[model samples]
Target: MTYTRVCPLAEIPQDGALAVEIDDTPVALVRSGEGVFALSDICSHAEVSLSEGEVYDGTIECWLHGSCFDLASGKPTNPPATQPVATYKVKVEDGDVYVSLGSDE
Candidate 1:
């Protein structure tokens, strides 16, 4: 699979996320526990961007509804959100963040 360069690793702070559009898809780049993750930027329960939410315990909580989603699986761990988001594959290369439209898990 081709790993496309997205952003610099320093752009995303620890326990923070950034929204990026690739191929017209908004992907959420999350930095949790010294790791980088990519997921669907839209909240499953709302049209809001997950990047606006806060990150804690490896999950991103929707700022609109307070719903939390797993960074690794994109699964909802809280109410008000039952639908699962799509998580992309992410890799860090020499301080740069690379993501794949394929798989990270």
Candidate 2:
């Protein structure tokens, strides 16, 4: 998977998320606790933006349905969401956030 620059690392809060549009697809970049993750912006339970949700405890809770997803794998950790969102590989270089849009992690 080829990595593409998403945004500056500082743009994402220590425990929050940011969304970037790549190839017409919205991708959510989350900084949950100590780890950074990349996942699809849409929530699995409903048509809501995951980037607008809250992130904590290594998970991102969808604001629409209140489903918590593992930031690392984009897998649902709670109810209201049985399907998992797609995840992508992310890497940090210097102070920039890079993502591989074609590959799911």
Candidate 3:
């Protein structure tokens, strides 16, 4: 799949999330442990940005309604958000982070 470079790997804090945009589509680039993940920046249950939420244990929680989504699956792990968000494939190369927005699988 084609991948677009997002940002330097160092830009993302460990266990934190960064808000980015690709082709006008908002995306959240999350760093958890040694792996980096990408997801729709918008929360499934709310019109809020998920990148403004908390990151923990491979999940990102929605700040508006306490909805937590799995970083890898984009599936909500709690209430107030039964719908799952979209997840994208991510890769790190040469200290840079690249994401494939077209690869939601």
* lDDT leader: 3
lDDT of 3 by residue, 1-105 (tens): 889999999999898899999999999999998889999999989979999898999899999999999999999999999999999989999999999978444
Candidate 2 structure quality by residue, lDDT tens digits, 1-105: 799898999999889999888888899999876678999999989969999998988889999889999988889999999999999888999999998888443
**Model 1 Cα lDDT, one tens digit per residue, 14-34:** 899999998888999999997
On TM-score, the stronger of 1 and 3 is 3
Give the range of the ten consecutive residues with the poorest summed lDDT in model 3: 96-105
* Clash number for each model: 0, 0, 0
Residue 42 alpha-carbon offset, candidate 2, angstroms: 0.2
Q: Candidate 2: which stretches are off by over 4 Å?
A: none
lDDT of each: 0.92, 0.89, 0.93
Residue 99 lDDT in candidate 3: 92
- Model 1 RMSD vs true structure: 1.6
TM-score of each: 0.95, 0.94, 0.96
| Candidate with better lDDT, 1 vs 3 | 3
- Model 3: lDDT equals 0.93
At residue 90, give the lDDT of candidate 3.
91
Measured on C-alpha atoms, candidate 1 has an lDDT of: 0.92
